[model samples]
Target chain A: MQSIGKRAAMLGVFSGGAILLGYVESLIPVLFFVPGMKLGLANLAVVLALYYFGPGDAAVIQLVRISVVGFLFGNLFSIAFSLAGGFFSLAVMCLAKRYGRFTVYGVSTAGGVSHNIAQICVAAVLVENVKIVYYLPVLLLSGLATGLLIGLAGDETMRRLGAPPKFYDAVSNQ
Target chain B: MKHRERRLNRWDMALVILVLAAALAGFLLELTWTGQGASLQITVDGEVFGTYQLDKDQTIDIGGGNRCRIEDGAAWMEWADCPDQLCVRHTHISRANETVVCLPNRVTLTVLGGEDGEVDTIVS
Candidate 1:
């Protein structure tokens, strides 16, 4: 129980760090290469959480980040989009981790792609026009590209973060 | 455990190459998708003012109000009646991240993925 408590505390810290990174990234002025397009810096934290922790923990972290950050930034209207993106990305990665014939990086890529697609779906719903769905192909392609980019980065980050001491012992015992 | 990478089969390679080719084609053809230089017809309101075309002398203004111009296959809102004038100040949009918004008019224009044949508009 003592060890478990310590581990939970560690996860809490990690979650806080990830959210801070997300918030900082959000503060930067958006640079759009095309109309209504933006580089997704904050999603890096989402990738990190997915990589280091189980998807459930990642989902919790994302929910916290969205709520806290959105509140601080007065982005209440964006909450639905964030929730839609977070749920889809986390769900996809969780399933992939359990059964897909892929590595963490591939799962991370899929998560990134799913996150963007889900957000766009929410946008289309809010806008109430199918024409808004026309953004699909381009968004998907960009998500694919960004997914690969973030996946590669997440892979490197996970490798560098090293194994938690307790986690290592538990896995070896299993 | 070390992360695994799936080996790309020939099929995967072929598909990747095909998608890359399509993206290239879309980027080149994007000039034709919207605006005055565009060969495709784009109607404003009830009338077909003009299609996307880049020819400075040949371009037709849409809605008989604001002007959206096309140059070398890219589109931009060059002028508008909106006070903020953010749309007019915006750089010509060719990439997916660009957009033009007329707050007063509630008109939002964006160039979709003619560059990659996929459209990614607003992300969460």
Candidate 2:
């Protein structure tokens, strides 16, 4: 088994990568007909964490990234929306990864769809209008496109990184 | 050892197709469903503040410094104090369940007709 110090170092690196991706996403000027739409670039980091670490560790990285990014680029309402989207998306992605017949692409697409749906729910409640759901169709299209992009990036990155030597060594030793 | 190629599989392609189909269906439904001879429903924060006939050409003060105008069987946002002015810029809506939303002002205007006059029912 790896030492605790080594795990902590890895988590730190993951969080740093997540935060940097979040910053880069914020810098991209993505204009959408619907308000509060985004490409969700930070999710690439979450996918990496899921592969390298685990779901729980990935959740931690996601939460930290949302909190930090929301504080820097948004307000309380925006933070609430992000938290709703992030948590729901993470849950769906984790479930798909664990119990469903889904690869990384399927999991990421589920995450993207759930994220948009959750954000729309928050917006509907906040604005007190069910009519806001009309925006769902466009949001779904955007989610699928962005999810596919993120999933491709994640798969390529993991293929390049390969399975670490430590994992095989630990399994053989056990 | 065999290397697994990093690419989208049939399963992923199927899921993408499914989502795209759903989105397309929704768009088509929204586009084709018309609310001809419907009434204009003005809602602020989800509450129906007022309803006006689409045939009635008049301007309504929608509170919060916003105004809506109905003319020529269509309704549009005439003026809005919101920063983005998106609602004001929106095209005239004359279809069932069509809506123009002002996020900044927390106001939504929709065209309701026949069985589609359920904004209150839906909200409640």
Candidate 3:
């Protein structure tokens, strides 16, 4: 088993990386003139955490990234949307990883779609109008595109980093 | 430590195709579901501002910062002083329940009372 200190340090590093990626993502312009459309580059860190550290650690990194980045760059409404989307995306990704015989691309794509749906749902509830769903088709396509890119990037990074230590798997298995 | 090759499998291909199909389905469904709207309703900060007939070709200044235009039975955000201007870039709305929203200005224009023949009974 890895020492507690070592695990904590790794978690901290991953959290910091996630936050930085979130901030970088915020800097990208809205693509295709679609409101709330994003590249979701921050999810790269979350995917890495999920694969290497398990869902529990992945959830920690995701929440930390959302809260810190949301407060830094967005308003209350934006934060609410981000939180809803992030949680839903992470949950779907975790489930896909656990049950489905899916690779990184499948898991990330599922995460992306769920994230967009969750955000739109929140928008509909807040605006008191269901018509906002008109954005779904475009949002879904964007999610799929970005998710595939992130998945490819994540997979490459994992390959280069090689496998985690045996004890790392032990921690994730728990 | 060496890991197995990380190439995508059939499941990944299936998931991608599934999402693409879902998107296409949603696009088609929306196209068929929306009917031509008779009027457009304006809401500012969750409160009703006014409702205007879509047949009336006119420009309305909303909250002194945004402008909406109704022409040829379609309504769209013609102008907005907001920084983002997302609403202004939104496509025209002629279908019932279609909307153009300006988040920065807290304004929303929703189409109502369409050819589907449901009268909007909600007052104010």
Candidate 4:
């Protein structure tokens, strides 16, 4: 396991990276022309943490990033939808990674699809309108596309970053 | 390290295929399903304010300062106090279970009276 200081430093870097990418993502206009839809560039940081630091650290990164980013850049409703999406996506990715069946890309794609599905579900509940579910098809397609892109980026990043010194490889290997 | 060494594999391809299949399924479902609402159900701030028949053309002054016109078998936002004119710009909707929502005003006009609408009404 890494020292406490090293862990904190890494977490800080990941959080910063997530926020920066989120900003970059917000700048890009989606092809679908829908609010709250993007490349999900922030998840790149989450993917990196999940692969490099293990799910526990990855989970922490997810929460901190959402809260900080949502508080700074988004509103309460956006935060709620993002939290719902992020939680489910993280859970699926962690499970897939731990199972060791799918590669990084597969795990990331699962995260992406689950993220959109969960977000739409929350939207439906909030609006009290099931017609919101009509947006699912578009969300699913975009999620797949973005997930694949993020996964590929994460794979290369993980390969390049390698493992940290004193890394808890055994724990993350799960 | 072992997991890291394992890059894209057959399993990864399988997962991609599965995701694509799911996406295709959703797309097809959306394309094929048609809204069959018989009436327009207006909701303001999540409350059922009124329901209007699609067959009848009428103008409505929805509570909370929103106005909509139903004409030619369709309903559309004629006026709204909301900042964004998204609801006003939305095309007339006549299909069952279709909706034109004004997020800022918390007004939703949903098509009611189809099979799905009946089920939704019961559930809501």
Tens-digit lDDT string for candidate 4 (B1-124): 4554546788777887877887789767755676555788887767787878777788889874789898888899999986546678776888765677776566788876466444322212
Write one digit per residue (lDDT tens) for candidate 1, span A5-117: 65577567766876777677667665543223444555667766665556676777778877877677645556655777878877987886677655655666567667767
lDDT of 2 at A32: 67
Superposed Cα deviation of residue B123, candidate 3 (Å): 12
- The lDDT leader among the candidates is 3
Listed per model in order, the count of residue pairs whose N, CA or C atoms clash below 3 Å is 24, 1, 0, 3
TM-score each candidate.
0.61, 0.79, 0.84, 0.77
Query: iRMS for all predictions?
Result: 6.5, 2.3, 2.0, 3.2
Q: State candidate 4's DockQ.
A: 0.35
User: lDDT per model, in order?
Assistant: 0.56, 0.79, 0.83, 0.77
Question: What C-alpha lDDT, on a 0 to 100 scale, does residue B52 get in candidate 1?
Answer: 41
Q: Sort all candidates by TM-score, best to worst.
A: 3, 2, 4, 1
Worst 10 residues of 2 chain A by lDDT: A164-173
1 or 4, which is superior by lDDT? 4
Clashing residue pairs found in predicted model 3: none
Query: What are the chain A TM-scores for all the models, listed individually?
Result: 0.82, 0.91, 0.91, 0.89
1 against 3, candidate with superior DockQ: 3
Enumerate the candidates' DockQ scores in order: 0.10, 0.41, 0.54, 0.35
User: Candidates ranked by lDDT, best first?
Assistant: 3, 2, 4, 1
